[model samples]
Target: MSLHSMGLELVETVIYLTNTLICVILAVLVTDAWFRGDHKGSLLYWMIAAWVMFAADVLFASRPLLSPVVARILPTLLVTVGQAILLIGARVNSGQTKVTLVEPIGAVVLHAVLLTVFHFLAPESPLRRVSNGLIWATLAYLSYRGLRQSPPVFWRSYTAPAKAFMAHAIFHLVRTVLVLLPLSSTSEALNTFVAILGDLEVSFFMVALFVGLLLAHLKQRNEQLSSALAEVKTLSGLLPICAWCKKVRDDDGYWQQVDHYFRNHSKIRFSHGMCTDCADDFRKEAEKLQPSDL
Candidate 1:
């Protein structure tokens, strides 16, 4: 091979290796999160999506060893299905939607059918690329919508992931448009550049997404801990109670019934009832008062 050809090959190898490394790291991070009790349905879906993408990357990198039909269909199917699942995961994570198998399953089936039909009709044509890109863009838009619909407190946490999905969508849409344009030396170079840029973009986005999710979970946990601590502190200080009346002294130096004090200071509510000894004494007093019961 010429020096230029050799250099291009080396660059391609490096890019593929880097992509593989990032996907593996992301998979590990997500798996750890799930084990650490981030076991939401959305998280599970996201993990599956990551693995599917990883598999697609691996298959593509080994494409030279595979037959033509397998080479085209497998990777495309993996990517399309993975994107669909990722969208569902985002929606579920946002707490705005419940997890349903229908969407992800249907998405996978639809992509598979479209890819199969297109392969027969026009193998590796602009039409195929356009269809693939539109499918991905649609899924990305749905994921972005889910993030946008998140509650205010959580929306901040989703910002990075949302941006990542948006960037992916835009990139694919541009690629689709580029495919439709007449091919030239310049356009070919641009397409190659876009492909390289996509790899780098995906790597950065995965790391950012992992960090964002971890921070979001930590923030939520910290808030819960702080609230619990405040409750403990509220009930912990010296509670001065009258030796005889059972009334408690308030912070304002006023005595109030124990039940009233607790009700005001905390969430405790009281039900009026006499103890066994008090109930017996009340019965004796009632019998004494009923003198004319001959």
Candidate 2:
């Protein structure tokens, strides 16, 4: 059957549009995170770049046959560059602890340049295979960096979002392999794999982006809870005690100045007053004592 008659065109169109929308969502999330103080610097740039590449992919797929080779190659280049930027940005945002910016960027640039050259040198051969392998390898490296650099608190707090991004990366890598394999012999199998991968990729990215947005808010809630708990820990209450000492020690520590300690440690307010017993004791003590005891 002819290409249009084979029913693949509609599927491809849908996949392209879905991925484009996912990328847009990711862009908005990255921007929001930067504004909310969760992320900064190169990561934001790379996300924006990825969004642009997704747009280009949408435009290219709209008229795939009519699009020029440069049109295709340019977006691939942007993807390569953006991936490197993201690697660097991860290091920067992570406080230079877990990710190393220089080495990863250098590796991505080297591999991408080699792949571009291979595309021209051996368009219809295994050199392209090697190039595709490099792409997956680079993605694996970046994923590793992202996982390693994220703090334990960040991990426990945002595990689902992290998994979403990792799953999306895996889907992209699988799709890359699918594209690299010779498709003439196993067209049906390959087409099914492509559709599945496309759906996974779109869902993974879109969900991850939204989850990331909510993650910052979740962290804020956690902070507020912690603050409130601390406030409750050292609060004091009115407890009957000996009036001779003029000091109060609760279940915790020996409080030197009850009013000062409570004011310092908790939200309790105090008013100075003497109880009936203390007032009567003071009055009787005064009556027994003469004006000049000597």
Enumerate clash totals for all models, in the order shown: 0, 0
Pairs that collide in candidate 2 are none
Q: Write the per-residue lDDT of candidate 2 for residues 43-136, one digit (tens) a residue.
A: 4654665566566556645656554555435555555555555556545545665555666567667766766676677655545544654664
The C-alpha RMSD of each candidate to the native structure, in angstroms, is 4.5, 9.8
Candidate 1 collision pairs:
none
Give per-model TM-scores.
Answer: 0.75, 0.60
lDDT of 2: 0.59
> Which candidate ranks first by lDDT, i.e. highest?
1
